[model samples]
Target: MKKLLSLFLMGLLVFVLAACTANENAGNETEQPDGEDTETAEKVLYLNNGQEPTSFDPPIGFDSVSWQALNNLMEGLTRLGKNHEPEAAIAENWDLSDDGKTYTFHIRENAKWSNGDDVTAGDFVFAWKRLLNPETGSPAAFLGYFIEGGEAFNNGEGSADDVAVKAVDEKTFEVTLISPQEYFLSVISNPAFFPVNEKVAAENPEWFAEAETFVGNGPFNLAEWEHDSHFIMEKNDQYWDAENVKLDKVHWAMVDDTNTEYQMFQAGDLDTSDVPADLSEQLFGEGKVEVVDQAGDYFYRFNVTKEPFQNENIRKAFAMAVDQQQIVDFVTKGQEKPAYGFVSYGFTDPSGNDFRETAGDLVKTDAEEAKKLLAQGMEEEGYDTLPEVTLTYSTSDAHKKIAETLQQMFKDNLGVEVQLANMEWNVFAEEQSALKFQLSRSSFLADYADPINFLENFQTGHSMNRTGWSNAEYDQLIQNAKNEADEAARYDMMYEAEKILMDEMPIIPIHFYNQVFMQNESVSGIVRHPVGYMELKWADKN
Candidate 1:
């Protein structure tokens, strides 16, 4: 398998090299000596995606609609830049109290929703209070765990209004934290933190949850959304930052099949989509395609509280047993790199080669050794034969194929019979969040470019920590790292916490995801940020 992967990767490298040369030649072919504009037609853009969004409400399902809808309909305290750092959005400037527990934000005075209402700090206050409301059942409420008294509030043990957020005035907001957090700004940029119009939402309680009910302060508004179909967003002329907004409109279509999207791009129906697996090489240097290694990771989570996987030895054995290279080559078609550690490569470290290299050693792959470990774990559990484990995944053929491949790998290596269960994407998400699955594959899009965003998920009480894995020692280390003012000391603490997770083996690192988009050469101003969101505000159809 290793040899095959090496050969395939080598071939892919050659193909990519040829593509790069071709692209360079094309650039030279189209070069205008100097001070020349190769401008073309303008303003409208067509976007293609796979899987229709399950909901437009940020507090509900996690889907493309939930993300794309917010781009035009709401504004958060901050927005992530291409580098994954927080930049000004509704809040223009912010300051942290010396103790790092209090944050004050100065709102952009001119910001307004599509309804023409001036955006006030009160709106953010109301939105956050509503998010922590136990009645609201906001799935991402765990994001508020950093806020003072948030956990208590979310648990229905305290009042929502008392959850550490206050509006000092229309243009100013203050947030008190339970403890100091290094990635507080990044967390604030998340969709769950986006501010909504309290009055409008109350008048039309169901509106905020529906496609047409949204009125945002974003660069675009939800013009139209067809369930299980496509969604359309039109430029918000009322956007406070409209002068910088470029695209007149954007059409987003959910398309799951890579070949289907490829065909759409070929027919000029889609401006861009992920490159198809079979045609990666042909499209590599073709003036119209763009591919980059994205800063994200895809991993499999084994529910630590569930049967079979509840055993630590089984978890560790599974983590060390799977061959990540094979999956990268066969499943993603050489689009992604094998992830050796939790943090993906390309993310710079404050001081070190990278977080992965700085903090740890990669898990060694040894099938025989893994089998021995599994047997020992089973014996320790007083079971002669391992219980039949069910690994769940989404309904897509690719996801199912990946799940089956993993099942077969375990069976072949460890003499364990594994079953595969597939569910629709949305259903799978609900099941995972509810701790209703034994094992599932998940992909994490970095909310920020820090190791904290990814590592925090495994912490106890984290909303996204569906596996039910937590260690008091690990949690303490994270909290200590946050409280530490010394940068080096903080990083060391973080590394120590990461080592705990690595040893726990609750998560099996697969590959760091890579983003691939196919577009026409004429499509300009499309920037791919590390967080995987396209800031269509500056996108130009020309």
Candidate 2:
């Protein structure tokens, strides 16, 4: 199989920022209650992070900081644009062979890493191949499924030599694809495709986590990281595209308490933080806070390998009882959109066709119908009574409320008693990976603006596919889509695959996530990605 190239024109870099500034009125700053005097501010942005990042390495890391830091420091052949589409970064121009199986990239000669090392095509060749290497255990290997022999290589079913990644010259890279992939260039923008210095990573296994050893080609470098206290990233002067990079420094602090984070923002101790469910109205009154509504999804995945869940009727009954709109309104305080599909609503194809609508309709809410389905499933399984199952969620107050709502919905509608388990976020992740829980929360922010990025993760044996789901028909549908040449035909196949999943009821769609934040009026330049997380480069303190 040869690697395929789909041409995507690069968009000009646009640094969008919020212009609002947090200036203290004299009446508020002093007891005298004077009318006008206030002081100017410096460019410093403080953010409140809910989870402390576990690692900084792209392969082993899985958290906000890990991805955010990489996005700021390391430049990939392609990058995520403001529109969340793939745009050229290090590769100024590229070409696809007439066969549509070979991609030849021409690296920009002026590109350099933070260490002043020349950015070359060889770096990408190493990076892509290294990710497919079994020993690397990159959680990101799922993103490489489109490359020639990539899936087989990751599964240990093929030799690493079979994977088609080659460097034609210092500036030119030739990658062969097994099939033409519509999202191939968009995949390149993902961190899984970001280049790493082979010489450095090989010599120092602990390079990325250490400040001094960290080598990056992006706009900023890891200046300092203190586990629970704070981490800092300073601007990298040697970055290839440094001219457009702004902000001298970024201070990232981990604040687990939503109230504390809100207070920090209110007191001007922090420039930006997510608004807690309690304080949204108070902060919204000031006209400084804004919401980025089209991002992420909050849903629970049921591990189908579990006996009762293995029965499709049981899963369908469970999904049909819950009203996602109510969940969004009551639990998320109406800050989010109800999710009708697995992939987010804002996601689209290259031609700008919305996948959320194209993917078949999700399970409808019908309590009376749910009861009949539950009874039928139990009878078919020859069970005298309903089986007991547990739905697990995080210990956060918001999560608890949602879980309780779901539990009540199931009980009242289906007449089944469900055990609700709440644990800390870390514990929940560990248990989910271990398959310790029958049902668990599994939300995703699309790594790229493609349905393939979300859909492919659920194929059998993938790490993120913790539900122990396996289906020959589902797998074949994905393969057929990948091999299908016509764009419309391929998408139709994808839509069919999603429809099959919905019919099978393997997972429940809860709500499309909305990133809600309450920042002080004084803060400025804060921008949000539909993928979640704030991009600080464009941020400034007014």
Task: At residue 274, give the lDDT of candidate 2.
Answer: 69
Angstrom error at residue 255, model 1: 1.4
Please identify model 1 stretches exceeding 4 Å from their true place. 1-42, 61-65, 82-84, 95-101, 178-182, 285-289, 346-350
Candidate 2 structure quality by residue, lDDT tens digits, 155-260: 8999777888888889888888888766688778767688888778788978887676888887777766666677667677777677776666666777777778
Question: Native-vs-model 1 lDDT?
Answer: 0.75
CA lDDT of every candidate: 0.75, 0.72
Backbone clash total for model 1 is: 4
